[model samples]
Target: MRDHTEFDSFAAFCDQSPWAFDDVADVRDVSRARLDEYVAGRTDFETWEEMKTRAAEEEIIDQIVS
Candidate 1:
């Protein structure tokens, strides 16, 4: 089994959320609390907000390097 981390949450979030990056409209309107709980269970992040913040930083760094 692969061990998931805070950075991993973003991909998982995107995969589960079909409307994740939809800036025009908010789709897949699921419960925020439910998403947070799911992320917390799979990762170290306690909240979905926290997971995004931290994971985004890593993604930025990766892009810069790439």
Candidate 2:
């Protein structure tokens, strides 16, 4: 497992990336056109699959730690 510092860095990465917060209600409510902008590299990730994979990994790691 990564140390707290690594986790903190990952958290910061998420904070700065639009794809990292897609589950937020306001983010989900955006129009398809707006979503396309983010998915097309307005943020760190280029596609929903990449973001989803990262989110799922985060969830799995959280479960293991908890």
Candidate 3:
């Protein structure tokens, strides 16, 4: 894996044409109300404990599959 610690500009990184397993899909436009609701729901994580637990669970699942 490449070291991304010192990476800066996102536009420059994107221009590199990085390899990806999945093909890019068209972006879907959504209403502001729907976006707000999604953001609000995700923001409900009350503490780092909950966030870390969720992240660990996701990492475990990813490792199992890949």
Candidate 4:
């Protein structure tokens, strides 16, 4: 896994990019909400596959929009 510093740097880079923030907020919000649901035992995906799939789809959409 990446260290916090590396993640921070990557986030900084994203913040600087024109492709960031605008759609990221919505995507992140949805992802967080879904994650919270899972954490609250409302779902049953022992792994992160579902979350990852949603994130990947969102990312693709973001890329297309950008």
TM per model? 0.55, 0.41, 0.34, 0.32
> lDDT at 40 for candidate 2?
55
Lowest summed lDDT across 10 adjacent residues in model 3 is found at 19-28
Q: Count the clashes in each prediction.
A: 0, 0, 0, 0
1-66 per-residue lDDT for model 4 (tens digits): 022112244346345433335553544544555445542342233333563555578679889999
Q: Report the error of model 2 at residue 7, Å.
A: 18
The sequence of per-residue lDDT tens digits that candidate 2 reaches over residues 1-66 is: 133123345445346555556445545665666565555553456555566577789889889999
- For each candidate in the order shown, give its overall lDDT on alpha carbons: 0.61, 0.54, 0.39, 0.45
Q: Quote model 3's TM-score.
A: 0.34
Clashing pairs in 1: none
lDDT of 1 by residue, 19-55 (tens): 4655423423657887777768767778777866876
Clashing pairs in 3: none
Ranking by TM-score: 1, 2, 3, 4
Locate the minimum summed-lDDT window of 10 residues in model 4. Answer: 1-10
Task: Score residue 4 of candidate 4 by CA lDDT.
Answer: 18
RMSD of each: 5.2, 6.4, 14.6, 14.1
